[model samples]
Structures are given as structure tokens and as C-alpha cells.
Target: MENGVKKQDQLTPPPVPRVAVVLFVLKGKSVLLGRRRSSVGDSTFALPGGHLEFGESFEECAARELKEETGLDIGKREYLTVTNNVFVEAPKPSHYVTIFLRGVLVDPDQVPQNLEPEKCYGWDWYDWDDLPNPLFWPLEKMVRSGFSPFPTE
Candidate 1:
């Protein structure tokens, strides 16, 4: 409420859900992930991606975020799935429609670095069957739904 006016009466629209792109950078049975240090999923492991910018394609967003956060490049991305993430327990409640994309590293030998230390702990390759504890809510939901981002033999 502003100046004794109720929030609903403010003449301003409510917040809108945002679209976030999460990448599943695959190499064999492993995927690239990092521990997020942000508002929504602090201390939780999550995929390497970010919000979908205006006028940017999903593939473009995936590659750009990968480079920005992990210092690695990707190739041949395809849509894996999407998750409806509502951070109801967060300090600032927020929602996001998370688009998951799967891609292979442009150079499998290239290691991912923690380009944004303030936002993430570090990047590492986690095997599908052996992912770390306390995964970001959306990601945990994705895994629990039996959605395997890995390519089948």
C-alpha cells in the first residue's frame, strides 16, 4: 500500500511472470551446473542459463548465457522441456516459466569457469544419476517428473 491506498487500487498492474531459459549442457552422461547465489535459489544447484532477453531466440539466449556464466560454448541446442516455477517461499515471491534446452559443448575439452562468482559458486559437470543435493526447486521438479535431458542410446 502506498500512502494508505491498497495495492490493488494503485492504478498499476500486478507483476508478470518472467521467462527464464535453463540450459542442460550435456557431455556424455554429465551436464553443466552451478550453485546459485541469488534471490530465487540461493545455495541451490541449477543449470547454466538466464532470462530470455527481448528479441532473442531460445538458442541465442542459451548460448549467450552459457558463455556469460560458464565461459564455455555450445552447439546444436534443442528444446527439452519447460517448468512452471513459483517461488512462493522466497523473500520476494516470484514466478518464472523455465524453458529447458539441451545442447552439447562446442569443445567438450573446454572446462566451465565461474564467470559470475557473485551469482554462482562454480561450474562443474554432474552425472545424471549423481546430481548434487538441494537442487533449485524448478530443476528438482523437472527431475522428479522423469524428464531425462540426456540423449538415449
Candidate 2:
């Protein structure tokens, strides 16, 4: 009504729900990380993850995403934490609900299969005490919160 024009009510859209998986491969205080492919986000180091599909449980999504991205089959999932924040690099700006899970490699010698060639390049294991700097922002927070990237207990 500022310029003598009648204002109309605008319907606000609902926030988009996003899901992510954080996998920790435990090997005496060491964890697994993957180098994201050149296309996904920064293509830097990050945990295995992706968006959740409709009607899929968070745990299932975690396992599926981990397997698809890293080619490692996880046996079980342990719930850790959920983070709500704006994901800038996602296809759309929306709320991200991160589901942290603890998993173990079914076979240590099996190399990860990067299904998405444009999403990840390779995978590696790292010690919790000596995590690489500039880790994915959310993952860095998970580490700082004293929650082991690979939860033991």
C-alpha cells in the first residue's frame, strides 16, 4: 500500500526437507572420508551422504547413500544427531536435516565404488585426532561437539 497500490497476500512456501548421512568407520580411533568428485559442492573431503528419498527411513537412506557413494556396505546404524541449517550448494535453498550414523566396513580391503563419477573421486581413512582442516562445515561441528566421527559407545 506504499505507492497507492493495493497489496495482495502472498502465500509463503513450506521449507524443503533434506536428509544427509554422516558415516564413521571405526578402526582404533580412525574414520573414513571421501574426496568428493569435482561436481558435487566443493569436491573437497567429506563424509558419505546424499538427499533422502520420499518414504525412505533416515537409517535406510544413510545406508543406501553410504553404499552408493562409497561402495561400502554398513551393517548397522546408530543415531547421533540432527542438524537444521541452510544448505547453500544444494539444488535448492532449503532446510537440511543431517542424520548421523555409525557404521563399520563389511570388508576392509574392498575399495569404494564411486557410482556417481561427478560427485566423488575417491575415499580414504583418517585418524580422529588428526582430522584434516577445512572439513565440510557440518562435519567439523560434529567433531567439535566431542562426538566421535566414528562413535564407539
lDDT by candidate, in order shown: 0.90, 0.71
Candidate 1 residue-wise lDDT, 1-153, digit = tens: 789999777886666799999899998889888999998889999999999999999999999999999889898999988878788888988889988899998888998999899999998989999999899888888889788998775
Candidate 2 clash pair list? 37-119, 37-120
Per-residue CA lDDT of model 2 for 1-153, tens digit only, reads 646644552344556676665666565677878776543346567888777788988788878888777778877677777787676676655667777777776666666776777777667778889987667767877778787654445
**RMSD (CA, angstroms), candidate 1:** 2.4
Q: How many pairs collide in each candidate, listed in order? A: 0, 2
TM-score of 2: 0.76
How close is every model to the real structure, measured as TM-score?
A: 0.92, 0.76
Whole-model lDDT, model 1 = 0.90
Best by TM-score: 1
